[model samples]
Target: MQITIKVLKGSDCTLEVAPTSTILEVKQQIETELQISAANQKLLLLGRPLNNEQTIASYPNIKEGTKLNLVVMKPCLRDSIQRGFRKHYPEQQAERLTNEFMTDFEKKLNEQSLDDLERFADSIVSRATT
Candidate 1:
């Protein structure tokens, strides 16, 4: 049976897949349509996790016109920070650049008094308004 897949934060699509088609196969098709890697996609119906190796026929909740949400998994905090910095600064030769920066920044923040932290927040707000 055909089904429409809706991504939580991305584009919606459809697949003309059979009820016997494996979930992994569905993910491959999603990867084709959305360009999101299968590793990052999670197809869910009514909050129940779908098994990658299971066929559509295995799930009674999924059928034609059924809306399955695609949730892209987020990397860990360290990976996110590293990726963010790498995306903006390609020339940085440091391997653990974001980790180093975040460690030092966290240390500084922990060392600051509560009043100083409040002032830091105020400064951020002032900068945004200016």
Candidate 2:
């Protein structure tokens, strides 16, 4: 069976493999073809992370012609532009976009002394209520 592998930072490539292939085996093939490390590879199956040990055949949702997207999070110059790319792809999803929208807020909070953060919040509240 044929499948399309889409690498996030790199280019997409085509592969012909059996449906019974293990997720780890597929990852190895991709790493061999792309010359990327396994640790850096993050595969999203229908927008969800795949377990390293899960087999493609085990997932009833995935079939013979399934398209797998392989995303590599190796830091790049573009990452510098965004300050942190985890915003684009959340390090954790439970927070929603609160982390992304408040990127500057987190940065400021981290940079400020604890007393400064309290004072800043106080000033904002005082001005808003007045």
Candidate 3:
């Protein structure tokens, strides 16, 4: 079966796939066709996000010529921070610091509310300066 994928920022692509194919497999095909990584891709059908483990057959409404929305997630914050640290530190030190920072940052991220996110960002800036 052929389905159309509408990317949020790029051109739409059509893929040939089986009805039994998992969403992950569809993502892999999109990765091959569009050069977008599977990890960063989010597939949606009629505004509902598709589970990577689910199959096309599971969605009874989907058939030939169905259109799925593709949303690409932003790059990892850890990777960006690690790259910045690499400019000033050795590879091993940068890795260690990035890991440590991510561990604490993730904890705070989970605990902080949307209202507290501004304060959290300020604290991160202060920590980075010191």
Candidate 4:
């Protein structure tokens, strides 16, 4: 099955792994793909830290199409701007924009942002359209 890794402020990617794969193995795969160190990766499944020692089967909620969020305490600049070159492709552009929004939302959540989620989302929509 495919597991979707959502980098809080970056584009999401899917990885194919066996159900018995350990969460740590998933992190290792992510580290290889995103160039982020495993030590720096703080993974969450539904807003809770995902234990590295557990197998994917241990978390029933983590089956096919499950989204796991990866929070990088310090984002790498090269990873961000380096991803911008494909702006001409609509699909790539859309993905880049989604990453930008997720990044912002994650930042606010960390700061205990007082803004209403709906309002914040609406602002993003408005800005995107204009």
Query: lDDT for every model?
Result: 0.84, 0.73, 0.92, 0.82
Any idea how many clashes model 4 has?
Answer: 0
lDDT of 4 by residue, 52-84 (tens): 899999998988899999998765653444345
* Model 2 pairs whose backbones collide: none
Give stretches of model 1 more than 4 Å off: 75-130
Question: Once superposed on the true structure, which residue ranges of model 2 sit more than 4 Å away at CA?
Answer: 75-130
Query: In order, what is each prediction's RMSD in angstroms?
Result: 4.9, 11.8, 7.1, 12.3
Per-residue CA lDDT of candidate 3, range 12-74, in tens?
A: 999998989999999999999998879889999989999999999999978999999999998
lDDT by residue (tens digit), candidate 2, 1-97: 7777888765888777666788788788887888775766788888998888877777777765677788887654433434454547554542444
Task: Please give the ranking of all candidate structures by lDDT, highest first, separated by commas.
Answer: 3, 1, 4, 2
> For residue 9, what is the lDDT in candidate 1?
70
Query: Across residues 14-79, which tens digit of lDDT does each residue of candidate 1 receive?
Result: 888898999999999998988886877788989877999999999988888898988989766666
lDDT of 1 at 12: 82
Clashing pairs in 1: none
**On a 0 to 1 TM-score scale, where does candidate 1 land against the true structure?**
0.58
What global local distance difference test value does model 3 have? Answer: 0.92
